[model samples]
Structure formats: C-alpha cells, structure tokens
Target: MTQWTAEQPIVSIRDVHKSYGQVEVLRGISMDIMKGEVICIIGPSGSGKSTLIRCINALNDIQAGSIQVEGQEVHDAKLDKLALRRKVGMVFQQYNLFPHKTALQNVMMAPIKVLRENPAEVEARARALLKKVRLEGKENHYPGELSGGQQQRVAIARSLAMRPDVMLFDEVTAALDPETVKEVLVTIKDLAADGMTCILVTHEMGFAREVADHIYFTDRGVIVEHGAPAEFFTNAQDPRTRAFLDQVL
Candidate 1:
C-alpha cells in the first residue's frame, strides 16, 4: 500500500456548486486531491460525475464556490485559463485527435502553439510520450488507422505531453470494446503507479478498485461516500454505496 504524506493538496474544491440554468448538476461538492494521489470518482450514469470532474479543470463554469489548482484560484479573471489547462490535463472518452494530423502532429501542436515551444523540442517530447505509451512506431499514423484502444493511448500521450501536474480522465474506456479496454486501463494503471495525480470518472469498478488510492461515490449531484478503496468497497458506511457496489460488482 502507498502511504499518504503530509504534503499539501494540489487540487482543492471548496463547496463547489454548479448548475446549468434550472438544472443543478453539482451541489456543494468539496474534495481535496493530494499531490501524487490517484482518485477515482465513480457513480451511476447522469449522476453528475463527469460534471464534477469537468468543473475541477474549469471546463464547466461554476456558479458558486471556488477551485484552486497548484495554489492558483481557477476562477480568477486575471489568471491565464489556458496556462491552467496545461497544468490540468484532461482526456475525454472520445479520442479527440485531429483527423488531418498524424499522431505525432496531434501531440506536438499544443506545445508548439499554446506553449510556444520550439517545434523540434515539441516533436522530440511528443515522440518520447508516444513511445512511453507504446506507440513508438505509430507516430506517423493517422487516428483512423489506429484501433480504439490505440487511439485512446494516443489521447493519453497527448495529455501527458503537456507535463500536467494533474490529469482528469472522464469515462475513458466507455467507448472501447471489452477486449480493447484492458490496454487503456493498463496505460492508466501505469500512470497511477508512476504517482500521476489523477481524477478519474469511470464505470470500470475493477479498475477503480485496483488503481485508486481513494474513491468517491456520487449520486444526484452529491458525493454520497468516499474513502480508501478497501473501506469504500468492502465496508461502506452508506447504504447507497453498498447498494451501488452490489449492483455493479
């Protein structure tokens, strides 16, 4: 088991409340994600798990409460949101690679344009990341040429290219075939093993049980239960958690 240290949390969400017009999606959601920790957010469909994760990275605007990432207030108008995005990498369920760009080009474009890094440096870093994800030979391949799992790996590689301090994964394996899910999960497992501070919103119960240091179970826009995986899964204090686990597990 990995020990939790006394280091300050890298991501802090304090009483966060978000709603889209009349529909309230998140209700006073507060959580602390420590540096080098992997947290899995699991819940039923339309339970606001994705909305909660998206709010942390400011992909969704919050009407109330605050979010702080790496000691910077996320909602601060003066703060560069784009720069903040680089620090908080997000991988979507869909592999959002550019159709016209090669795998290498898709990874390289962000650093070159957003960070204004040298093309040579960006390309080198992109290649190294692709290699890390075991796509060393597919750098020149287009997204269409790769399988679903391979494309997702490329998406993971693209997110890592920014050297993010925190990574957010939203149902990353929901779109993959059951056979292909393992490869993406393996990549994520490697990330967790490497101490990448991650917030994953997924339905893969087995994956969450194995990779998550901490797990939060959400329902109807609230975090119903949260604890170490062992406690959360085996000895849950909340009836809702137990019921949910029983149904899924």
Candidate 2:
C-alpha cells in the first residue's frame, strides 16, 4: 500500500476528453481528488458524470489528456489494467451479483479467483465486510433471496474485498426502491466515514450534500462549478449550477 500526503491528490484527472463516434461525452474535465476525500458529482442526464468516472477507471479510454491514480498513469499501455482495477473499486447502479452464489461467496470470489489469494483469508475478510455493510447474517443467502438493498450492500462488500485505494460509485442507488435506497446510501456513507477516498456520480442531491467533501456540478461535458457543500449548495456562482440546484435541491 502506498502512503499519500494530505496535500497530494490520490486521483488526478487533467483535461480528459472522451467521445463515441464523434459524440463527445467528456470535454476537458479536470479534478484533483485527495486521499480520504469524498467527491460527489451531480449533473443533469447526459452531462458526462458517469462517463467521467468510467474514464478514470479506464473502462472507457480517453481521447486526450490524462488520469492518474496515486501517480500511476491510468491509460498507459504498459500499465496493468487489472492492477489498476484492484486499486480502484467501482459499484454500479445494478447489483451485479452472481445469482448462483451466496452473499459470502459473491464477496469472496474476486480476491480468491482474480488475485489468487488464499481462500481462507478471503472468506474471513468477506464475512467482516458483509457485517460492515450491515448484512451480518445474510452470508448464506443468494442474490435472489436478498432484497435490492441487501444485494447492493453485498456488491459493495465484493468491491471492498479487493482492498481498493479508492472507491467509485456510479449511481449505486438509482435502481433500488425508494425505501431501499437509504440502506444502500448508509452503507456508502459508512465507507466515507471510515476515511475511504471516494468519487461518486449520483442524483441523490440530499445525500450528496450531506456526505461529500466537495460537490462538483457538471453540465454539457464540463464542470460548471464546484465547492464545499456549504458554499456549493447555498451560493452557486454559475447560472447553470444555480439552475441545477434549484431543480434538484
């Protein structure tokens, strides 16, 4: 594990550009995310919020500029993409759990299979992670037997099994029932509270305002404004940002 200073950014994205067949999704996006910081990205649909995080993890390659995680260039051809993924764990909207596996098995699979870690150690960690997400006794339950929130929590535990340096959440609550969303959000909030560096792309305005260290508003593939929650929510400088907050908040 690499030690990072408070002054240094664990994740640095500089003027990144992404497009699909001339439909540009990200344009000159830049941000510096420090270790232990919780950054919430909010914007209208098609504003590139999800695309930007995807580019950070190299799931979508960029057309120009750079993204670095802990001084390692994310898009370097020689860079091991799997290694990068191990350091950056991502949870998406859908809980992509293996239907055949139990919650504990779902969490244990990646570390044991992908990292070739010892099964015993992986299982132990998986149990602890499940408990951390408040799914203490669901270890034996399959995905189909669990609620949406419970399955999502299992997905979070699965990501944590990799022991990532940073966690990326891309609308992890979007698919859940309104009642289930709070449980999922609470799991994420606990991760943030535990000093995990996180970058979240979400539409949950209130949750974002409460948990984020910095709030970034992106529009038309560009960051229109960003600031601490107190300032960003109360005194947005950009017209676009103000309009966005008015609608959401």
Candidate 3:
C-alpha cells in the first residue's frame, strides 16, 4: 500500500452535475482522489462512468459544480488546456493510434510536435516508454501490423511518454478479445504497482479486486457505495450495490 501523506487531494470533484440536453447523466457527484491511490469504478452500462472521467480531463463539460486537478480548476476558461493535458494522461477504449505512423512515431508525436521537445530527446524517451510497456521490438511496426493487445500497449506507452502526474483509463480493454484482455490488464497492474495514481472505469471485477485500493459503485449517475476493496466488495450496505454485485460477482 502507498503511504499517502499529501495534505490535499490530487483531484477533487464536488457537487458535479452533467447532462445531455434533457437527460441528466451525473447528479451531484462528489469525490476526492488522493495522490498515488488506485481507484476503480464499477457499474453497469450507461451509468456515467465514462462521462465522469472525461469531466476530470475537461474533455466534457459539466452543467454545475467544480473539478480541480493539482489545485487548478479543470473547467476554468483561462486555464491552459495544453498544460492540463500534459499533467493528466487519458487512455480510451480504442487504441486511437495514427495508422500512418510507426509505434515509435506515434509515441513521439505529442512531445515533439505539441510540446516542441528536442527530437533526439523525445525519440530516446519514446523508445524507453515502448520498452516500459513491453513493446520494445514492435516500435518500428505500424498499428495495422500489430495485434490488438500490442497496439493497446503502444497507446499506453504514448500516454506515459507525456509523464503525466495522473492517469485515467476509460474501459481500456472493452474492445479487446478475451485472450488479449489479460495482456493490457497486466500492463496496468504494473503501473499501479509502481505507485501511479490511476482512475479506471472497468468491468473486470477480478482485476478491480486485485488492483484497486478503493472501489466505487455508481448507479443512475450517483455513487451508490464506495469503500476500501475489502469492505466494499464484501460488506456493501446499499441495496443497489449489493444487487449489482450479485449479478456481476
């Protein structure tokens, strides 16, 4: 377990509400994510899990409330989006790699192009990140040539190349085949073991049990229950949470 001594949360969300026109997706959501903590969110489809994480990164807008990362309001109009993105990395369900670029180039793009980092230094770091994700030899291959698992690993390496303080994974293995799912999960587990602060919206209950320091169960846009894994998974008090666990577990 990580020794969490930070005086304030790395990410703080308070009284958040989101909607798509008439349909309210998130209703008064609130949570504090401490540095170096691994938080896993589990819930049924259409429960606003993806929307909530997207809000943290300011990829989606909220109707009310506030989200802050490292003491800066995420939705602030004057905020530097480039700097925010550099500090917070996000990986989606799809690999989303540029098919035209080699794995190495895909990992090197943002740092060199957006950040204007030195080409030589970016190349070195990109190669090192590829190795870190266990995709060392496939660096020269394009996304089309790699298997789904390999491409996803490359995507993870691309995210890591930014050296973000926090990582958000939104159902990263949802599109993968069963056999390939374990590979991506293993890579995420390695990151968590190294004390990376990660927030994941995942359906892999077993993975959530093993990797998560805290587990949150959301339903109908509200967090129904949350607690340390040992207590949340076994001694859940909310009826909705217990029912959901019965069906899934």
TM-score of each: 0.96, 0.96, 0.96
Candidate 2, 1-249: lDDT as tens digits: 356566789999999988899798888999999999999999999999999998888888999999999888998899899989999999988988999999999999999999999999999999999999999999999999999999999999999999999999999999999999999999999999999999999999899889999999999899989999999998999989988888887
lDDT of candidate 1 over 1-249, digit per residue (tens): 133234767898888888888988888888999998999999888889999888878788898888888777887778788879988999999978888999999899888988899999888899989988888899999999999999999999988988898999999999999999999999988988888999999999999989899999999888999999988888998888889889999
Q: With candidate 2 superimposed using the best TM-score fit, by how many Å does residue 234's alpha carbon deviate from the native?
A: 0.6
On the 0 to 100 scale, the lDDT of residue 6 in model 3 is: 63
Model 1 misplaced stretches (Cα beyond 4 Å): 1-6
Query: How do all the candidates rank in terms of lDDT, highest first?
Result: 2, 3, 1
Model 3: per-residue lDDT, tens digit, 1-249? 244346789888999999999999999999999989999999999999999999999999999999988888898898899989998999989989999999999999999999999999999999988988888889899999998989999999999888898999999999999999999999999999888899999999999999999999999899999999989888999999999999999
Question: By the TM-score metric, which is better: model 1 or model 3?
Answer: 3
